[model samples]
Target: MILWGRPSSVNVQKVLWALSESAVPFDHHIVGGKYGGTDTATFKVMTPVPRVPVLQDGDLTLWESHAILRHLAGGVPPLADQWMEYTTSTLQPAFLQMFYELVRTAPADRTKDAEALKATFLAAVAPLEWQLRKTQWLGGDSFGMADIAAGAMMVRACDLCDPLSPQVARWYEQLQTRPAYRAVVMTSYEELRA
Candidate 1:
């Protein structure tokens, strides 16, 4: 199997963390963000949209970060898939709004209301903060794709927003202890700072 994307991407980080947890070995090539390889004809054929984190496993070619994640897990866990979808639909958009305004946009070029962005993000993740209180992991009994999905956003949001919630902070700290999270998700995203 092979994966292509810049590691700083939250979506890419999800796939990398999942691969690390599953102990699956594969080649990785940095192919987006500042690295600039997404336009190549070879890449165009690999994915319908030019984007980071495309995966090729034998004859199977997968696009979309969560789809790659589901394939990695063999089959989706019910609760896990539910939350992962939540991340894609709700949490992720909220995260990107804040992240792009705060991190990816140069200060002078930033026009969005930072306080509003933060407020929206915190509100969108309120359910996740509540969920972590009931279960140690989002995927019910064990940490799985659901955690990988939302957790990636949670980790990035740590430095940007005031505080998501107390439970979120605690979960962030616990995730820091994981080597995979540290290596993939916690790596400096300075390259992404505008």
Candidate 2:
């Protein structure tokens, strides 16, 4: 299997974390963000959108990070899938807005967008605080794809935002202790930091 995407990408990191958790080994080729190979004809043929984290397993080529994670997990856990979707659909937009505004934008230019995104970011993460109060992991008792998806975003959120709700902070700390999360998702992204 060949995985194409930069390690620093949250979407790519989700796939890498899932692969590590599942004990699946594959060759990874940096192909997006600063690495910049997604525009090639071969890459275009493999994925119409030319997005990061394209997975090639024999004749099957898969795009979309969550779908790749689900495939790697063999069968989707219903609750895991729900949290995965929720991460992308609910949490990611606000997270991305704030992340880019604070980490990618110049500090002098950050306040307006950061202020605008703060309420939405807080609202989006509220569910995770509530959910973590009951379960050790988002998918329930064990770490799974849902954690991969939401955990990736949560790591970035915790890094760039203020104090997280108690349960959410505890949950994020637990995720950080995982070897896979540290290796794949929590590595320094110096180039991405403002």
TM-score top scorer: 1
- As for candidate 2, its clashing pairs are none
* lDDT of model 2, residue 104: 87
**For each candidate, what is the lDDT?**
0.88, 0.85
Give TM-scores for every candidate, taking all chains together and pairing residue i with residue i: 0.96, 0.93
Q: Give the alpha carbon lDDT tens digit for every residue of 1-194 in model 1.
A: 99999998999999999999888999999999789999999999999898989999999999999999999999888988999999989989998999999999999999999999999998888988788888888878677888898888766687887565777777778788889998889888899999
Least accurate 10 contiguous residues by lDDT in model 1: 162-171
- Predicted candidate 2: what Cα RMSD to the true structure? 1.6
